[model samples]
Target chain A: MTVDFNAIPLSQLSIGSSCRIGEIGLNGLLRRRIQDLGITPGTTVECLRRGPSGDPTAYVVRGTTIALRKEDAYQINVFPI
Target chain B: MSITTEKDFLQELNKEAETIRLSYVTKLGDRIIADIYKNAEQISKNVILNDTNKKNWTLKLDNYLTSKIFGYPFMLLVLGIILWITISGANLPSDMLATALFSLQEILSRGFLDLGAPAWLHGILVFGVFHSVAWVVSVMLPPMAIFFPLFTLLEDLGYLPRVAFNLDNLFKKAKTCGKQSLTMCMGFGCNAAGVVACRIIDSPRERLIAVLTNNFVPCNGRFPILIAIGTIFGVGALTGQLQALAVAGIITGVILIGVFVTFAVSWILSRSILKGEASSMVLELPPYRRPKIASVVYRSIIDRTIFVLKRAVSVAAPAGAIIWIVANTYIGEISILNHLAGWLNPFAQAIGMDGYILLAFILGLPANEIVFPILIMSYISSGTMIELESLAELRLLFIDHGWTWLTAVNVMLFTLLHWPCGTTLLTTHKETGSKKWTLAAFIIPTTVAFTVCFILTQTVRLLGLG
Candidate 1:
């Protein structure tokens, strides 16, 4: 398997930051659901803002704002651009 | 190291391995997904043109809408405004419908008498069946005709997904998927559909949680009662837009209570019976679009308003006939309807509601829209009955029947919390394919409704406030 040692989970990306998605460590249904939402390897995601409860954060990707919860976001590795 | 050889690895795995080796196969699937996306990007670069400025406007509106600071307040304001519009706008039309329909009832009864129809037949057909259906229509149709279109307009504008986005975390705290909020919104239109919408949740446990708690949100059938009572009580001193705003605020407060109860029940269910996997929350906020007015109006009127009205009228007509019979038939002196209310009075009063109201809810099991009609029939359908003319008359009738503010408050709470209507229960049984789950869905909300009202009634009585 190819691993990017420097890549951090998308959940760690600060608000107003942009990054290129790296290897998604999630498997099976969770991985497939994310893939269906248009988040794939090398895709770019920009952190918009956190929800009032500070768990799910909204992001701009593929011309839409998709809310992703922290745990799910944590599985998707991203390279800071 | 790389040559630990594919052939050697394959031979070892083929001969000795008990489980299938799928690590490489999984990686290959991921590679294929990535390749597809990459190829799509390549094609889009050549064919798709840029329109950064057009996209920026939607993004800009969303900045405040999805922002933590303004999100909650904006949600309340938008909802309040929509409701205010519905309330004030429906008043005239509802009155017109009542006058038009009630007058027709008089003509129908007179015509039946002229045609040499038997008095018993006149009583059942004209006064019992047709009267009740007419009441449901006059009271229900105008508001629905107004409310559904406005709601559908928001839905068509793609604003509802953003609402789901805003409330995702709150639902997360309750251990259900954010998409439950979307189903709950659908529930505001109808709960039967909302239970069906629960299929969108991937995990079984979360789906059940959504289904069970869907009743906490009042459906369209209950909204008119909520709106009417809120306006009558809260709009006492205010006039014009201020009155509308006050009424809307009260309705919004009721909705907030409903939401709070939904969260609390979801929290309990997740920890207790429905506990299992963590909920999966993923919501796509589609770009806001210019809504097509013609399509929005057509769909809302045809699909929501007419469909719901038809169901309510069908049930109400028969229920009205039964109620008329019970109210008319005497067992010694008091009528059967009164006898039943008398029997139920002790328990109903204990819950901060009267026996007639309780009986109405029971008889209205098939359709919540007819609860008001049944209640009216119970209270005044005898010889001294007068036509329901306006809010003032309705208020006077309630006050005559011992309805204080506390009674009003408890009635709203019960309406918000009670068991799902017959259609919703049937839908739940079908969706879950389990009678146990269907019974749980019924038992859970009912228990919640009775307990909440009981505590409130007891507390108020103990304090001597009411």
Candidate 2:
């Protein structure tokens, strides 16, 4: 079944848990860029750090550390395992 | 429960159960994955829904401004508008300031004479120091006053992220972090601040690239020199409606050229001296917020405009006074100002600028704003050592000395591409914590400036245009 990552709050995911990024609902370059970073469907992601701003959070995806603004991060649908 | 010692019986039982157990394991995995997906979805949805409720008009505005398509264009347009407004608006105040300050110079000169002050005192105080300071203020103040507020408004609006986005790809291609663009933007106001801003870029190699190239973007202090050259060299070519417009356009073009060269040199450095993979940049475009106009104006004018002006003035005033004294104080034959200019003359000629102009540039190294004043001191004191109150008179004086379009173009190029001033150099040294990089910063731009001027002067002379 197709599931949206936006349905769950990122804060609910404990650090070190692995998840698969589905769709990043953001439109345009930000969406394309996230997908390019291997935050695509079936890719494994691990929460690395929460930023002070409570946005611009970081995650490890496809062997690379990436930071996403909370807004865009919300748009991304990730299936956790 | 068949015993493994009865190998035949165990193998038969294992085969029968394997197919059934495999299905169970697959089902369990899917169920766990599904549950996790549902949780992440719920978390993200709840936060966004809450955000929508709390944020009102301000948040909406921020979103629009920081939207991918609109953000980059908006930032560029705002920057262009600020430059346009500054150039157009500053002209009136600048002329008035020059008129007012020069009149004061005359009054001071008369007061010194009336007080029966020695010729040397009058020369040092009125002709040397006061003239230089007055010239610096008249030329440097207005644009800075106008430009800083507009720039700060963008910063407060949180549009800088979008700027970083637009330039990220180019930086990535250079094998540098995209965050370097933000540092470069910071450099526009001041290279030192830009160097500090480099802390945002995580990779050591990329951060150094940003630091070394920060000075390529001219700061507030250097605007006076550029404006002077633009007004004199480029403006003279056109007539009527085109004249003023042409000047502003050329200056903008020159600034754009500086940005382009910044990227080019950065690319070269990243690929060669700082060889590394392109650091991944996943920048989040912050939602734009409503810019606070009143605060922007206050901070930009008081915090940045006035602050930079104060620094420039403080350094310039003493330099001016010293230059004036040197010009007036005779040592046997030529005054100190003349002797210094004479010494620099040969080297200056090779670089397409004269000795006096080059000397001014060196003396003005403490603060770029003082360059014009130093140049004026050298010129005025080279002869009668009288303080002129009007830009018209200053122009006439330059005309008397045979300054043409070539000199103006060369000056503008040199100003744009020279080494960072003493303060910026120190900032670079401190930021990098390395004398080697600091020296490289100085040498790279100086070399570029020399090469550009040499080619330009040669081309002009070859065309018989000079």
Query: In model 1, where do residues sit more than 4 Å from their true spots?
Result: A1-3, B1-24
Candidate 2 lDDT score at position B370: 82
Restricted to chain B, the TM-score per model reads 0.94, 0.83
> Per-model C-alpha lDDT, please?
0.87, 0.73
Best by TM-score: 1
What is each candidate's DockQ, to 2 decimals? Answer: 0.66, 0.10
* Residue B377 shift from truth in candidate 2, angstroms: 1.4
> Considering every candidate listed, which one attains the maximal DockQ?
1
- lDDT per residue, candidate 1, B1-466, as tens digits? 4666888998887865533445766677778988888888889889999788767877888888878788889988888888888888887888898899889999997899899998878888877898888888887888888888988998998888888888888888788888888899899889998899999988888999999999998998999889878876657677777887888889899999999999999999988988865656777877788899999999999988889998988888888888888889999999999999999999999999999999999988898988888898889955576887888888888898899999999999999999899999999999999999999999999999999999999999999998
**Candidate 2 vs. true structure, TM-score:** 0.75
Cand. 2 Cα-lDDT:
0.73
Q: Which ten residues in a row have the lowest lDDT in candidate 1 chain A?
A: A48-57
Candidate 1 clashing pairs? none
What CAPRI grade goes to candidate 2?
incorrect
